[model samples]
Target: MSHEFTVETGLVAFSVGGRAQFGWLDLVTGSFHSEADGQCINDAIVAVEFSSDVVH
Candidate 1:
């Protein structure tokens, strides 16, 4: 029960565990930005990676 989306350009937005998150991949700068709680950036990325529509 996973959800996937294709983003060609601009910003990609989503939510996880009632928390709002935003991500953007900058090809020019070779940098990525994700906004979420805590200082652990990996947590945000992981949350987006393993996200699903079905409740577990």
Candidate 2:
């Protein structure tokens, strides 16, 4: 299993708070930093391109 990012795989985050956020995701190496303080995310998680959920 490959949890790393490829050429087409990248990360996109939403600003759920009032402040602006930033992240750097390297597609070739599958690396990322999601905060101004330089906090790294879990490297063991799988990167999924598509996700779906339905509610009835």
Candidate 3:
């Protein structure tokens, strides 16, 4: 939404079955999940809030 960017992180989500979902995301791809992909919603939020990148 509004383009995939860190600043737009707050305004992005996937609406599946009419339910809000924060799927896997990447700095490039934004909100989307793939098999063995980026962090989940909880982990992602924590990373951003703490100003830390996931140690992949």
**Top TM-score prediction, candidate number:** 2
Instruction: Evaluate all candidate structures by whole-model CA lDDT and list the values in order.
Output: 0.40, 0.45, 0.38
The Cα error of candidate 1 at residue 16, in Å, is 16
TM-score of each: 0.25, 0.29, 0.24
lDDT of 1 at 44: 33
Q: Estimate, for each residue in 1-56, the C-alpha lDDT of model 3 and write its tens digit.
A: 67654432322443433434434345664544422444454323322222225533
What's the CA RMSD for each of the models? 10.9, 10.4, 9.9
Write model 2 residue lDDT over 1-56, tens digit each, in one string.
66754434233434434333344556666665563665655442433342237422
Best by lDDT: 2
Pick by lDDT: 2 or 3, better one: 2
Residue pairs with colliding backbones in model 1 are: none
Candidate 1 regions with alpha-carbon error over 4 angstroms: 1-20, 35-56
Please give the range of 10 consecutive residues that has the lowest summed lDDT in model 2: 43-52
In angstroms, the error of model 1 at 4 is 26
* Model 2 lDDT on a 0 to 1 scale: 0.45
Which pairs of residues collide in candidate 2? Answer: none
